[model samples]
Target: MNIKITGTGSYIPNEIQKNEDFNNHQFFNENGSKIEYSNDVIINKFKKITGIEERRYASAQQNTSDLAFLSAQKAIDNANIDPETLDYIIVAHNFGDVDMNTSQADTVPSLAARVKHKLKIENPYCVAYDLLFGCPGWIEGVIHAQSFIKSNMAKRCLVIGAETLSRVVDKHDRDSMIYSDGAGASIIETTKDTGGIISTISASYTLDESNFLFFGKTYNKASNDEKKYIKMHGRKIYEFALNYVPKAMKACLDRTRFDISDVKKILIHQANEKMDEAIVNRFYGLYNEEVPEGIMPMSIQKLGNSSVATIPTLYDLILKQKIDNHQIHKGDILLFASVGAGMNINAFLYQF
Candidate 1:
């Protein structure tokens, strides 16, 4: 039996946070020194590098799990499957459900359990849990689902990538501008179909790169309040991704014994536009070929980096014909890849 993604869905929050919104805000360096550049200058440079002009933010009433449930429901409806038949519910996220009023993350009940409860799937046999594998969490969840189906442990599974980065960001840090909130989900199951997952690869560089992305105090050193928010060494991550992501992608593709020209579209994590372009270029460089036009579809220009949600969300949008000039058809070969916080990297080859 082939493991396949039967249906997909995404939930992009309604509130839009524009770059101009940061004009009046104070920005600081990691060392607590005030940024010398004007807000306009900084924002312009940010736009050029990350390709993000605006991003979505969840409303006060919505948490990460709520967003996950909304997306999961849509996926179920899209697949036209009975919720009670699901054998597993896997939710991937870095921070748990973070309230709008507090910085604390709540995971007393796993996000998957919460989603299962919300979906009202009463089957006790439906195992539910959460996975935290950085931005690649969603893809990792899919890998796990595939393993379960192949091992005869499960027949149907729901995997979701959801995050409320806005609630976990340090407003004083400029990097916070790179983050947004959203969720994406998919229904994966055994199928007799022709195309599905082809090959997958995953790796972690924890020795020196462990702290490339981590939680730290605000950039404002004067503030005595002890609170930690998501932080990262942007330069370090950029270098790490460029050096390793391409190799991982090529390795995954090599395993499938497929030529590089066979890939139709690459759905990479929308972390940084420049970084992603570099990774793709390098991947092609490995084969001594020029990068093809439209080989990749990007949502970062409008979505920012929603961590685990980027790839699946992009997939949902393209499948629904929401992205202009980009479409996926049967027999098309697609490459999905991501690099994020754990200093982690992963890629999967899929045939649609």
Candidate 2:
């Protein structure tokens, strides 16, 4: 049985924060109260170096689950599937709502319940849950969903990739200057004779080696609005993206019983344009160094890095702008790859 994606949807913050915002004023750490800057000198310097004009920010009012729910609804509507027909829902993210009953421990049930109630999904029961491993979370959602359908545990599922990176971005640091908030969802409905994710490969290295780029908290159950922010070894992360992406991509291609030539197009986690270029360049023998435009960049210059949501958001963009032109034909192959906080790298081959 092939689990195929029938629809796609995404939601980004309504507000846009420009380069000037950082240059205009100084911000203090919510806990330490340490100031980041005294003036606009450094912000301009960053503008010249990174070429980022603006980025998105989620309001203090919105939480990760709220964004995930909206994206799921959009995907459901796009698929035109009766909300009642979905057997399960998976919301992927590093953050979750702050409720004792919100969602935790096991993601499969609590997440399903949250989406079922919030969307008013009627008739059929929905199994909701979360996947918290990090950026690899989204592709893992697809692999996990496929297994459920294979075992007859579910007939149809909605796999969501959601992120609120803006909530954790360290505005004080210029290394991670590009970051924003967004949510994306892809409809994965079960069918024995169709196209979908055909292969998925995951590999994790030592955490101590890759925890160089990460965010931590003052307390275990830290508030998102607290002094919560990201910390990173920028140089280290850039190196990881370059090193891990090709290995994972090749491993996925191998699992799917195909080569780079078998892939019509590739979708990668969009950490930055520089990193995207590095990976794309390596496939010169496979793709001729010619990655079709609008696919690789992920339009991240404006959206920044949306974490788990980045690849799905890029997929949505690909569908909206190019599906009708070159097209995802019957039996076509698609690939998804990512590396996140846990230092895990994952790749998947989709037939669509």
Candidate 3:
């Protein structure tokens, strides 16, 4: 038996936050000093590096779990499967249900439990839970599903990646522009089909890279509030990803004994466009081959980085023909890779 993704779905928010919207806002450095550059200069430099001119934000009424539920519902419908038959409901996210007005994350009944409740899966045996593996959480959730199915613990599983980063962002920091909100989900199950998951690789670098991304106070040092917000060492993350992500992808592809040319598409986390391009270039260089044109599809240009939701969202969009010039066909080899907080990295090879 092989494990395969039977259905995919995603919920792109309706609210659009453009870069020009931040022009009036004040941005500050982490050192408590005001940024010297004009807003246009800062945003222009940001676009040049990250390729994000706009991003989606969840409406005030929506929480992380709500986004997960919406995406999960679409996946279930797309699969045309009964919710009761699902053996597992795994929700992957960093921040839980963050309210619109506060930074406190509500994870009391786990996001998975909340999603299962929202899905109304009355079967108590469905075993709903949540996974927090940083931006790679969704991929990690799928990996866990594969493990459970292979171990006879589950037959059909629903993996969802969702986040409300806009709610947790520090408005005073320029890095806040990199965050948005969205969710994506997929139904994975055992199948008699020929192509499925071929190989997977995962690693965590915590000795010195642990705090590359973390929760910290806002950049405005004048604020005496004790509330913390999402923060990261952007340069550190870029350098770390460049050094490690390519090797992880190559290692995953190598395990399948497939040539680099066989990879039809790469769905990487939409962290930064230039960084992703460099990583893919180095990945191809490992095999002494030039990067193929259009081999990687991106949603970051409009979606920004929705943390764990990035890869799955990109995959869902491509599969649904929502992303132009990118399509997935049967017998095509695909690589999925991600790197994020926890200083974690993971990659998996899948054949469609």
Candidate 4:
């Protein structure tokens, strides 16, 4: 069964946080005590480590579901598909707008119900929900939608990746510098269409259990969990990317029976530049230097880390910025891979 994406869309918060913003605030609290730290210290540390100068963040009023809804609506309209006909809707990521509901509860049902009210398809097979291993959730969602459509279980499915990292960010901690907020959407159908999800490959390293890098949310909300900040094991993730990326790339290439040279572009997981450079250097040693010229790494030195949204966000940016100059022809191979919070990793070779 061939699954294809009919349309794509994305959304970021309206608010932008600059380096100076951090310079003005302290990221932690002493729980009825006192502390000495400001955003300036964190900002400088972020520059030294990730090289990011600014990032966008959702406001207290906004949530992940809002971003998902915005992007999903655009993708649905762009596809020219009626929401009433949609058989499934997949919500990825760990955040949402509604505070009391599950991510999907706050997300899928609300979006689908809105569509029903607007598009008139009050019922479409079923409104199923579950979590993907994340990092890999969007691809997994596309594949799942394809299976459903092919099986006659549904006709259309919308997959979303949304995160309010800022909501969970421990501003007092330097590790929080690695996360931001955003969302993305993709419309998938069970057809041999010109654009959509293609083959996907996932692999992991069990030996490096310590490479979890960092935990996303703490039960105590950072103030109690090591100063309420995101603590990242940078060197560990960096090393893991260097050692695992090449092997993972080879595995995907092998699965598709395509050589590395056959790939036109590689949309790598937005690892920081240092990690990218080191991994690419190691990639050359393991294989040839044919990883393509414009390897899309979304860590643009200032966007911070957007978790799941980074991959598709980069794809959208590339589409908008370079499509006129470098037209994406039929069957152009677009390779994508991402390594996220749980030590999860995935590679999807998309044919546009």
Candidate 5:
């Protein structure tokens, strides 16, 4: 069975938090107390590195499932498919519906199950489940759905990546500036069409677990309680992305027997602008060519790093012509890549 993405949708919270918002805030240590850092100094460093000017934060009452529902509904509508017709609903998220302020994680029925309920899909055959694959969760979920289609187990699948990172980020930490909340979704179905997912590759480097990113219980001054928050060694991740992501992309292209010059657009995870640019540049460099300026598009400037939701959201924007000069035509070849928390990296070659 051949798989094609029929439609895509995304939702960003209405609330906006600018980089300057962190200027005067005290940086937090492991004990959850504040260290001193001027907001201007930190903000400038963030701008130079991530190109993030601001990020969205979900409302206090909104949960990850809620965001997923919004994005999924738009995708379903765009696909013109009935909710009950979906064979699978895979929701990708690291932390479940965590409290926006408390940073408490909760996944009682699975985010996919909650999304199914909210969509009012009563079909017992419409299996729903949650996937946790670090920040590449959504991409991995898409790869999984393709397997089901290849085995003739499913006809239509809804893959949604939703996260309320604000709840999982310690505002007192500089990393919080890079984390944000949003949802993105896509409808993938078996199609006779020629342009879809052509080739893909995914792998992880986890020989020493301590080297990769992980969540640790930290002090949250806001809630005055110990909470699990995301923490990572910045240098390690930066080096890993620079070294391996380009290799991954080249491998995928080689497997697809497609030339990098033929790719029209590159939609990468909105993790960090500088890192993404470097990854694409290195990939093109392997062919001894200069990286084309417009071939790669970015949303990290405004969206920050939304983990799994980044790629789909960026894809949706491109599909809707929201990004300048970034339009997708039928038969246009595109590249999607991401590397994050799992110390994982993946790339997919797709034609639309």
Candidate 6:
């Protein structure tokens, strides 16, 4: 049975946060003390290094579940399937539904359950749950869906990755500028045809687990309100991406016996443009070939890093021909890869 992605959809907030938006603003360290840095130099470095000029931030009135609902409905409609027909709903998110004021995440209902209720999916048989695998959550959700379909446990599944990073990011921290909010979803079903998800794999290393990335409620003396913030070591992550990400991609391609030339697009996690470009170039180096231009489509310039939502959203945009200079044709091959907080890495090979 082929696990086919029948439809895809994504929703990004209308509120744009530009690079210049941080000018002359005070930033704080983890201890909450203010740190002085040239805003122009920081913005210029961000633009030149990450290629991110702007990103979207969800409004205070919106929640992660809200973003998920919109994208899920669009995907369900695109799939032309009744909501009741879905056998599973897998929502991948990091912080669940964190409020803008408190930065506290609520996980009791599970984001998947919240989406199910919002979508009016009444059937109890349609199992819905949340998966947390750092930024690879969405890809991991797709992997689980494939397993369910292969084992005859499910026929059709809706996989969604949604996040409101704006709610958790520390406004007083520079890293906050790189986080945003968005959601992306896909409806996958079992099909008799061959072209669909070809191969999937995931792995994790915990050596630097606590240092690389984390999210929690922490106090900032600069702000009157308490907030949960994302913290990370950029240099550490960059090194990890350059080393392990390419290895993971190679493992997936080798498992499927496909080469760099066989893939049409490489939709990777929109973390850093420089790191992503380096990883792809290094992957091609493994084959003693130069990296090809236009093979890796990037939306990080506009979307920033929406974590789990990045790859699926990019995939949807390309599939719908919404992204200029990028299009997916029938029989096109694609490779999706991501690395995140758990020190986890994953990859998938697919054919359109």
TM-score of each: 0.99, 0.82, 0.99, 0.80, 0.95, 0.96
lDDT score, candidate 1: 0.95
Q: How well does model 2 score by local distance difference test?
A: 0.70
Stretches of candidate 3 exceeding 4 Å from the true structure: none
lDDT of 2 by residue, 107-159 (tens): 33455467677888775567777787677788888888888887989888888
Question: Per-residue lDDT tens digits of candidate 1, residues 1-352?
Answer: 6889999999999999999999988999989999999999999999999999999999999999999999999999999999999999999999999999577989989999999999998999999999999999999999999999989999999999999999989888999999999999999999999989999999999999999999999999988858889999999899999999999999999998789999999999999999999999999999999999999999999999999999999999999999999999999999999999888999999999
**Overall lDDT per candidate, in order of appearance:** 0.95, 0.70, 0.95, 0.63, 0.87, 0.89
- Listed per model in order, the count of residue pairs whose N, CA or C atoms clash below 3 Å is 0, 8, 1, 8, 2, 0
Clashing residue pairs in candidate 1 are: none
Q: List the residue pairs that clash in candidate 4.
A: 5-196, 22-39, 23-39, 23-40, 27-171, 27-172, 222-228, 223-228
What would the per-residue lDDT of candidate 5 be over residues 246-307, giving only the tens digit for each residue?
Answer: 99989989997688788988888888888888888888999998887798888888888888
Q: Worst ten-residue run, lDDT, model 1?
A: 220-229
**Cα deviation of 65, candidate 6, in Å:** 0.4
Which residue window of length 10 is worst by lDDT in model 2? 98-107
Collision pairs in model 5: 23-39, 331-352
- What is candidate 1's CA lDDT for residue 158? 97
If candidate 5 were superposed on the true structure by all CA atoms, what would the RMSD be?
A: 2.0
Estimate, for each residue in 13-116, the C-alpha lDDT of model 6 and write its tens digit: 99999989988566666676666567787678768888899999999889999999999999999989999999999999999898777677898899999999
| RMSD per model, one decimal | 0.7, 5.0, 0.7, 4.7, 2.0, 1.7
Q: Compare candidates 5 and 6 on TM-score and give the better one.
A: 6
Candidate 3 residue lDDT tens string, 29-95: 9998999999999999999999998999999999999999999999999989999999999999999
> What lDDT tens digits, residue by residue, belong to model 4 across residues 254-312?
78766666677776655475666566556655665644556544544555667767666
Instruction: Return the TM-score for candidate 4, rounded to 2 decimals.
Output: 0.80
